[model samples]
Structure formats: structure tokens, C-alpha cells
Target: MRKPVLTIFYQYNPWQSTIGGIQSLINTFIKFAPDTFSIRLVGTGADNGQVVGQWHESELLGRPIQFFPLFTLLDDNVRKLVPTTVRYTAALLSKTLQSDFMHFHRIEPTLAARGWLGDKTLFVHNDIPQQMSSAKGAKTILWQQFPQLYFWLERQLMEQFDQVLSCNSASTKFYQQNYPSMVNRIMDVRNAVDTSCFKPLAPGPYQQAKQQLLDRLRLKPSTRLLLFAGRLHPQKDPLLLLRALAATPPESDIHLLVAGDGDLKSEVEQAIEQHNISSRVTLLGAVPKEEMVTLYQVSDVFVLSSRYEGLPIAMLESLACGTPVVTTDCGQGPSLLTSESGLVVSQREPQSLAQALVTVVDNPQRFTPEACMQAVSPHSAQHVVEPIYNSMLQRWHVSQANS
Candidate 1:
């Protein structure tokens, strides 16, 4: 018998470096979903302006990936006007018309191709209106001018999906409130981590790893390491993290490890110089995913000062690595964090974040490594993927029966 096929549509290439939470979620799904389901990943080649109408084949995590690129014929300005989902809809549908199940990374694509989305599942990674409103420049102006129309379209698009999966309760609640008639279709399917790769290191190995990281950074043994891993953009608010570091006393043995890069790189450098905390902060720009596990294990605490989020994978990985967190109440941070795992401050202020960092590091015993690891056990790939796969199977079976 032939295996059932699962086709995934995403905006960006998931194989690229510095991937976000959505990519991580897709990667987990591709890695753990049963062999009975043959998966095909369709995405644009916008990263390199590769040719359109071509299917690129690659293997990730021992699974075959067939990527379909779109928008190659359009200019940058024209592509920007059309959302990635809309621009790539025809290409995606052309390649996956016979798929047993179609999975969308965002709602726009599902909306653009709704007529052909038989047995489809849409994943909501963030609050759509909030994300648009947070944009700067021309995009912000566009959103301001047509807010109602945009939301109406978003709601209509979302309602068409057979099942809507949200990465956090905040997103699920937003959708539920906006489309009350389709409340039953929305479900919270939290993002997950590779627990085997992120788990706490053994005592001897842990000490060795810590020493190696410290030596490489030329830091003292007594210095406390705080890690921030994400894009250095307005939404992530890396500037806020820098200001918080400035608020910390110079004598404090705390040091920060910035593990990603973005448009605000220069600003982050300037802030370090302006605050005179150059020695306390190290910007390791765009560290590979493989190295993140070590960084998490070596850090005293993982910190995130994002203005908003939809369940950050960095925070989840930090907890899985047995490191406590100090983050602003963004996305699922408020609910995912507890006294046993870490601290969640109310505001995204420098002083509040600094205080929380001090409290977490000063009283490290309060958040045990075991407790931190246990807190994220429910988000492990093994635990989260089974239910999602089962849901897909049930949906496919129902569709078959109806057919």
C-alpha cells in the first residue's frame, strides 16, 4: 500500500540558518512524524533569488524534503506587495494537489489557496494584526490605513482551514475571540524542543563544557553567564536587554551572550559602547543551531526581553537544557514560567528585567536544574508530535470516509 503524503507550505526556506520558532516546529514535525506519512516541504527560494517553477530536493534529519520555489519572476517591490502566501499559492497548489493532507505555516497561504485546501491544517505562529501593527515604515502605514479590512480578511481566511493549530494560548485566544463561530476548530498545540539534544549535561561533562565556553570567551570562573538568543530586532528588543545590563552594577559578575544577528546589530554595538558595559556583553552573531545547546547548558540563566512573541523556541530550549529563564511576559512566558523554573516579570522595562536577573542568579538554588528540565518535559518532541500526528491521521481518515 502507498503511504499517505503530507505537504507543508511555509514562507521562508526552513533549511537556512537562524531559523525562527515556526521553522523549528516544522523541523520537529518532519523529524518525529511516523514513517507512514511521507512529507514534502514546499517553500520559496527568496533567499537566493533562485529560479521559479523548479522543485529542489534535499534531506533533513534523515527525511526527504521537496521544496518548491515561487515569486522568482517578480521584482522585489512587487513581491513585497503580495504576501508570501498569496505569491506562492499557485506554485504550492500545483505541486501538492494530490497530497493526502496539506499543512500551512500561516493563514494567508491557506486563505489564498482555500479552494484547493482539502484536508488542510493551518498553524498560527503569532497574532496577525499585532504583528502587522508592530511593523515600521510603509508597512505600518498600510496596516493603519486598512486595519478593519485586513482583520476581516484574516478572519475569513482563518475560518476556511479545516483545523487551526496555535503555538500558544495567547494566539489561540486571539483567534477564538475574533472568530467565535469557529472556536471549535482552533486548538493550542505548543511548540516543542529536541529534549535529547537539549537536556542537562552530566556533572563531569557539564563542568567541562562550562570551562570550555568560559575559556573561549576569556571570562573568569566566577562570572555569571546570561544568554540571549534571537534576532536583534525591534520586536526582540535587544536594546532593552542592553539597557537592563547597563542598569546592573558594574561590580556584578554578570556577563551576557548574544547569539543571533539582525538589522539592529550596529545599534546593539553602539549601546554596549554607550553604556560602557563592553566587557560584560559578548555578541556572538548568528551562532549555528548545533552550538545553541552548549550555550544554553553553560549559561547561568537564559534571558528574553521581546516586546511580543508566540512561544519562543529559545526559552523552551533554555528550560530543556536545565537553565532557568528571566523573560518579559510575552506569548506563553507568563504561563509557561513558574517559580520552580524561572522568573517572569510584568513589564518589559530595563529595571524590572535587571531585578529579575539578579533574583534568578543570586538565588540560583530556588530554580533547580531538575525542576527546569521537568517544566518543559511536556514540550519535548516525543510528547508533542504524537498527538499532532494522530490528529492528522484522524483528519485524513475522516476526509477519506467523506470522499
Candidate 2:
């Protein structure tokens, strides 16, 4: 029997090295489905002078990946006036329809409108703009600006798909509540993490680099470190973390390592200074990927004070490093920690977070490094994700035979 062609559509190329949730999906697909399925990944190429064309191809981790350079020089005004980007995307979908099955990454209205879904089409739900806006109702002016037409179309096309996979339990709840017709087909398929490079670090060059970072940042030996990594954006709520840290005494022997960068870097820096914790907070900027494993190994605790998430990989990596986590009850990922793994605080509340941090530090025995590692077994790519990929292919074959 011939292996089925599994086509995956992504808005951005997986090689861009941007910290994104979609990258996790691409990595999981390539890692788990390479043998049973012939993978074809399609994405938008660089923003160059070219209009639209199949610009490049590369063998990424044993998968055939194609990038289409669509509207190279895309000015906001020009893109708004012309639907050339969508037109080109439709063409790409048209070409990829020969695949036995299709899996659309996110609920993009333009892609959904193109109607390239096969008998075994799968919709992976990451976030819902409509539900988000409704939840924030009066307080969210920014969320209200979301494209109404696009959101409505997303809801409409969701019902047209054959199967749906949610990133977590919360996402499943949201979809079931809003799009009941598709609930029967929906299943919880949490994001998987790659353990090849994210395991616990041993003493070596990585250890030397960790010491250098500590010395350069003037982090005292007695200082207990708490890390907040990922984008420095409004959604990430770094300001709240600063407030939580500020509630402690000036004499407190604690340090917060802010890793990653984004639009709110200045705002976060200003907030740190405003709290008079400049000496205690270290903005490591963007640390190289090779150094991250070592940093996680040496860290005392991992924390993510985000207002939203879809199973963040950093949290899982922290667990892989056997580092205990303390995160906000932002989404399904944090809730997975359970009482035995780490502390989960109230969302958007710095005071609550401050209390939780104090508790975590005061009773360090509550967090066992062994437990952290044990909690992450279900997310391992080999054990958890490979079966999901195989089942997806099997379902496609069964559907094709019935037709």
C-alpha cells in the first residue's frame, strides 16, 4: 500500500527561528510522522521584491518543505488594497490538494474560504478571536478590533471540517461551547516537546557559560532565581511580574531573569526600574538556543506570567530540565502542572502571584525535580505524538475506503 501524502499549511516558514507555537507543531509533525506519512509543508517565504512564486525548497529534518514567496514587498496599504497574498495562498492550496489528507494549522479565514479540505481534513484550534473578545467584553478595546468577518468565517468553516484537534482542554471547552456541531469530531491533542536538545544539562562548556552569565550579571550566590521567558508583550504581562517582585522587601535575595525580547522591552525595563528592583532584575535579552538548556538546568524555578497561552514549550522544557514551575492560571498548560508539580496563581493578579511566589520559596520541598520530569512524560514526542500522527493517517485511509 502507498503511504498517504500529509500536507501541512503554515503561515510562516518553520526555519525562521521565531519563538512561536506553530514551530512546535511543525517540529512535532516532522519528528513523529516522517516514516508513515509523506510530509509536504507549505509556507509563505521571505518578504522580498518578488510578487508570488515557489521560491525555494529544502529537506528539513528529512521532510520535503516548500516555501512560496508571496508578495515580497508587502506594504500595509498595498496589502489592504489587493488580496494578492490570499490569491497566492489559494493557488498553493490548489497545488497541494493532491495529498490524501489536509491539516490546517490555524483558523485562517482566507484559507478556510478556499475550500481545499479533503475527506479527512483536520482543524487544529489554537485560539478563538470571538470567544476572547466576548470574555473581555467591556475591558478589551484592542481585542474588539479583531476582524469580525474573519472570526465569523472561522466559526462557519469549523463546522465543515471532518475532524478537529485542540491544543489543550480549555481550547476543547471553548470549541464545544461555541461550535457544538464539530464537538463530536474534536479531540484533545496537546502540543509535544522535542527532548533531543532540551534534557537536563551536565557539567561542561554549558556549565562554564552559565557561570560567566552569573558573574557578568552580578547575581549573588545566595540569590534565588526566578525566570520569566518568552515574548515581552502585553499578553505576556511582564509588568505584572515586576509588580509581584516589587512587593517583596528591598533586602530580598532574589533575582528575576527575563529572557526573550519583543515590543514591550522598554515598557518592561521601565517597570523594573520603577519598582526599584533594577539590581535584582536581569534582562538577559535574547539568549542563544544552545545556552537555554544550561540556564534551565541551573535555575531554581521557572515562571511564566502570561495572560494567554496554548501549551507553551518553555514550560515543558523547564520540566524536562527538572526545574519546578510557577505560572499564572492563564490557560490549559499551567493547569497541567497540578498541585504536585508547581503552583498556579490567579490570572492577571500580581498580588496573588506575589503570595504564591513567597509560598513557593518558603516551602521549597513542595517542588521535587524528579516530579517535574515525571509530569512531562505524556508530552514526549516519541511516546505521545507519534501515535496521534499514525492514527490521523489510519483515519484517512479508513475514510477513503468507505468513500
Candidate 3:
């Protein structure tokens, strides 16, 4: 039998170094997939005019995977402006044509490549339709305006795929009910974490790291640290964290670390000022991947104030590192959270979050490091993700034979 060639499509390239769940998931699949298949990562790259080489190649953990840049400039004349989308149409199509299977990590890129993807697959990182349905304020109004068009697009894009793998249980169920014709094609899998890298630190080192972070921030030794790490988007709801922080008691000895950046960053800053909690927050924008473990180790608890999520990797990473999570009832993250692992707010309100944060912050022993690590141990990448990849490869073979 010939070795299968699989290509994965995502909006951001692995080289971007942006803190995002989809990018992390693509890289994780590449690193953890069995060595039977040759993989290529396809994404839009922005290299303004500093093109060192046409094609970039490297190995992850000594395993090789090729990257085909959909939109990077080859000309030195173009300064820092992103070149036209028209220039990369041919490149994207050619890359898709040459692969045995093309996997998309988001719906936009999949819709962009509609009608021509051979042996196509789509991964649902977040449920867009569900988001629209449950959203408040402007989203509800906009969704109402184009409800028919939105549903039509959802149907049009999903019908052509050979398989659909979802990390969100709610998303899987949503597809199953609306598109009963394709229900057999969808498989639900947990978002994975590599336990080896994300596990907890020893006691002495943990305390040293905690104290160092507190000292660097000029916070007292008795301060309780809370970490909120993810893209500062509406889905992650960075502003909600600020509101929760404000709602905490006036004398609460706690500080929050915001570790990612996005469109909501300016709004987050505004909210912090409006809530009068500027002194209690630190914005650590776009943290390096190497330092993530240390970030989790120093915190008393990990916080997810998202409006919605598919099982966030950062939440899993937090738990794996012995840092319990306090989250809204967003998605799969809450399923893993227990009283011992963490707490989930009854609603997505500032007061609810504040109460939960105070509860966890005041009683650390009730949610110990060991219990947190034990809660997420079963979702290890090797155990949860490798089989999904293997099954995907098998499904690709079956699809091709039938075609």
C-alpha cells in the first residue's frame, strides 16, 4: 500500500507564533500523528517583502512535515502590505489537488475552497451556528437578519466533505440533528494535551516560580494569582474577566494575568479602567510557547470567561499542570471540571464569576494540584488524539476506494 498524503488547512501558519487554539491543534496533530502518512500544512503566510526563501521546511521532534504558504510575497519590491488574495488562488488549488486528503480547521477557509477539494475533511473548533443561536446583543440581531443565508451556507459547505471531526459535543449534536443525512460522517473527539510537557512542577520549584512572578509584579507574597490565557476575542470574553475581577471584594488579595491579544484588547483595557481594576491586572501579551508551563505553575487557578468554546487546550494544559480551572458553562472544559478540579459558574455574569473566583482563591487546598492533574490525565494526546488521526487515515482510504 502507498503512504497516504494528508494536507491540513488553517487560517494561520504554524510560523505565526500566535496564541490560538486552532493553530495549537494543527501542530499537535502533526506532532502526534503516526508516522505512516506524509503531512503538509497549508495556510496564509504574511512575510511583507523579507522573503528568505520560496519554500520553508523543518522538523518537529525530528519528524518532517512540509508547509505550503498560500500567500507570501516572492518580490522584494512589496513592502509590508499583504499581497492580493488573487495571487495565491492557483497555489491553494494546486496544493489541494496533490494531497490524498485535505483537512480544514475552520469553516471560512473551507468555504473559500468550496466545490474543488478532493477527499475533503473539516474540523469544528467552534460551533458558529450555535454561537449565533445563543449569542446576545448585536450578534442576535445580525443572525436574525441573515438566518436563512447562514443556514444555507452551513448546509452547502458541509455536504461535500468525506468526514467531520468535532471537538465540541454540542457542535457534534448540532450537526447530527440538522444534517441527519451526514450524521454518519461526524465523529466527536476530545481536544488533546501532551501531559509530558504540561504536567505540574515540584513543590519547591512551584513556590519559587510563584514568588518570582509576584515579586516581579510588585505584588505581596500572600497575593493569589489567577491566569486567563487565550486570544482576547469575544468568544474568549477577556472583558468578562475584568468585570469579574471588579466584582470581587474590595480587599481581595488577588491579581489576574492576561496572556493573549486580539481585537478585544483595546476594549479590555477600557473595561479595566471602567471597572477600576487596573491595579489588579497585568497584560502579558502573546507569551512565548516555551514559557507557558511556568505561567501555569505560578498561578493559583486558571480562568476561562469565554462566551463559548470547544474544549480549550489552555484549560486542559492548566489542569495538567496542577492548576485548577474556574470557567463559565462554555463547553467541554466544564465537563472535566469538578469540585476538586475547579468550579463552573451557573451563569455568564460578573457576580457569578467573582463568587467562584473568591471561593477557589480562598480555598486552594480544596482544589489541590494532584487532583487537578488527575482530572485531565485521561485526555493525553497520545491516548485521545493518535487514534483519531489513525481512524481519519483509514476513512480516507475507504473514501478513495469508493470514489
Candidate 4:
């Protein structure tokens, strides 16, 4: 018997080396999606005026991954009025036809490409209402360009996708409630991690990386390291973690590493200065993929101070690394962790997060490595993403029959 084949066209952030949930999700999909599925990702490249109108085929973790960049020639200044995503949508819309399934990772992208999508499409919504309702969303292209139709666009785009995968249960309900007509398509799925890459590391490389970081920080081995890995955006609220660090007792043997880069870089740097805890927090922007795993392994506790989320992949990756987490209310943290593994504080409260951090660092045995690994096992790619891949294929098959 022969295997059935399908092609998936994925769109998210531009093709760049960034540490993020959607980027990690793309990696997981590339590594774990069935051999029968051909993955073609579309994003603008930092191609330096070189690779426009070209298809670049590459491999990730030995699995084939293809990429296409639509608008690579425009200068950064020119891109302000005509964004890469806008260019991407314009070109795809004008194309003759496209792949079997078009999977998008954001609301605006789905809206931009709605006219070009088919019934087998998927939208991996992060947080529809929460993100869309924010002041940030108010400034997005959808609002700036078509202010009156943004909400209508959200409702209408829901009808275009065959499936909508939410990163957590709350987001699933958000979609179901806001777009009741498309409720049947919404699915609540936990974000997946590459267990193969994100497990507790043994003494050699892990120790080297940990020791290097410690030496560079000029800190003793006894220092408790709190790690925050994600974009420094309003949604992530990295400054909240810095504020919590400020609230901690002055003599506490704790240090924080914020491993990400974004629009809020200056704000975070300013907060560090204003708080006058420069020694307590180190803002190491955008650590590499392999080095991130090392940070996860060596860190005492992982942290997130996001205003809202749909189960952040960084959180899951941290858990998979056998690192306990202390985070503000978000994602599957409530259900995926126990008192023995992590703590989920009330949303947006720096004080509660401050105490939770101290508690997790103090009771290391309480948040055991064994427990963290077990808690995140179900979210491994084998257990979650493969099923999603198979279900998508099955749904697309049915769609073909109905047509």
C-alpha cells in the first residue's frame, strides 16, 4: 500500500532566527508531521536583496522543509507602508492556485489571505479575543487599513478555515463564543515540545554551558537562576518579571536571564536601570536554538509574565527540560503542572510572582525534575502533533468527498 500525500502551506512570522512559540511549533511540525505531508512555509527573508521569487528547500532535523519568500527586495523603510505580509498576501492572492491546506498562525494573516484559502485550511489561533481586543491590536494593519471591518473580518475569516487549533482550552472557548457559527471547527490542543531536544541534560555539555553563563555573570554556583524566554512584547510583559525581581528581598541569591529580543528591548533596558537591579537581571537577547536548550537545562526555574497567552511553547519546552516554572496565569499551566512541579500566580501581579519565584527556588526538591518531565510528557510531539497531522489529513479527505 502507498501512503497518502498532502501539501501544507504555512504562514507565521517572517523567516528569521527568533526564539518564539510559533517558530518552535513550526519546528515541531516539520520534525513530527507525517512523512506523507509536504511542508512549505512562506515568510519574508532577510535575504539582503537576493532571494525574491525563489523557492528554497531545506531540511530541519533531517526532515524536508521548504520555504518561499514573496517580498525580499523592498528596503526596511519601504516596508512600513507595504509590509512583507501585505506583499506576501498580494502575491499569493494573484497566484493561479495553492497547496491543499493553508495553515496560518495569526488572525491578521488569515484575514489577509482569506480570499485565497480553501476548505482544508487551519488557523492556529494564539488568543483571538484577548490579543485582538488589546491596544496593540488597535494599531495593527487590519485596524489601520480597514478599521470598520476588522471585527467583521475576524468573524468572516473563521468561516474559511476547516479547522482552528487553539493552543489551550480558553482560546478554544474564545473562538467558539465569538464565532459561534464556526464553533464546530475549533479544537483545544496543548502546544507541543520536542522532547528529544528539550530533556534534562547530563553533565558534559550542560555543565559547560551552565558554568560559562555563571562565570560570565560573575555569579557563584549557589545563585538561583530564573529564566524568562519569549519576545519582549507587551503580550509577554517581560518588565513584569523585572518588577517582580525588584520586589524580591535584596539579599536573595537569585538572578534572572531574559532570553529574547523584540520592540520592548529599550523599555526592558530602561526598567532594569530604573529598578536599579542591573546585577539581578541580564537581558541576553535572542539566544540561539541549541543554546536555548542549555539555558532550560541549567536554569533553576522558568518564568513567564505574559498578560495573556494560548499555552506558550517556551513554557512547555522548559517543563520538558525538567525545569520547574513559575508564571502568571496563562496557558495550560493550571492543568499541566502540580504543586510539586510549578506555580501559576494570579494574572498581572508582580508581588505574587515575586513570592512564587522565591518559593520555587527555595524548595527545589518540591519541584522535582522527575515531576516536571512527567507533567510535560503528554505534550511531546509524538503524543500531540502527530494526531493533529492525522486529523487534518482525515478532515481534508472528507472535504474532498463532500466537494
Clashes of each: 0, 0, 0, 0
Candidate that would win on lDDT: 1
All-Cα superposition RMSD per candidate: 3.6, 4.4, 4.2, 3.5
Q: What C-alpha lDDT does candidate 4 achieve relative to the native structure?
A: 0.74
Model 1 compared with the native: what TM-score?
0.89
Candidate 3 lDDT, tens digit per residue, 257-310?
A: 998876677889999889898899999988876677899988998999877778
Residue 145's lDDT in candidate 4: 45
lDDT of 2 by residue, 1-403 (tens): 7777776665554544444555555766775675767776655555543335554556666666544544343321112333434554655554534356666765542354355546445545434542365453332223345557755766666766767777767677777788777778887776677777667655585456557767877776666778887767656678889999898665657688988776678888889878888988888775655667777777777888876666777888888787788887766666679665688987567788877776666666788767888888788778767777767767868877987
Query: Model 1, range 1-403, lDDT digits (tens) per residue?
Result: 4667888877666555644677777888888879879888776565565566676777878788676665453222122444545567655555534367888876556655667646778887765545556442233224445777867777667766778888878678877887888899988887889897888898899899999999999999988999999877677788999999899877779999998876678889999999999999998987767898899998999998876677888888999999999988767766888798999988778999999998888887898899998889889998988888887787777767777
- Point out where model 1 deviates above 4 Å: 46-52, 71-98, 127-146
Q: Candidates ranked by TM-score, best first?
A: 1, 3, 4, 2
Candidate 4 stretches greater than 4 Å from native: 1-15, 48-50, 73-87, 111-119, 134-148, 203-208, 395-403
Q: For candidate 4, what is the TM-score? A: 0.87
CA lDDT, candidate 4, residue 156: 68
Go through the candidates in order and give each one's C-alpha lDDT: 0.78, 0.67, 0.77, 0.74
Identify the runs in model 3 with alpha carbons over 4 angstroms from their true place: 46-55, 72-98, 112-118, 137-145, 396-403
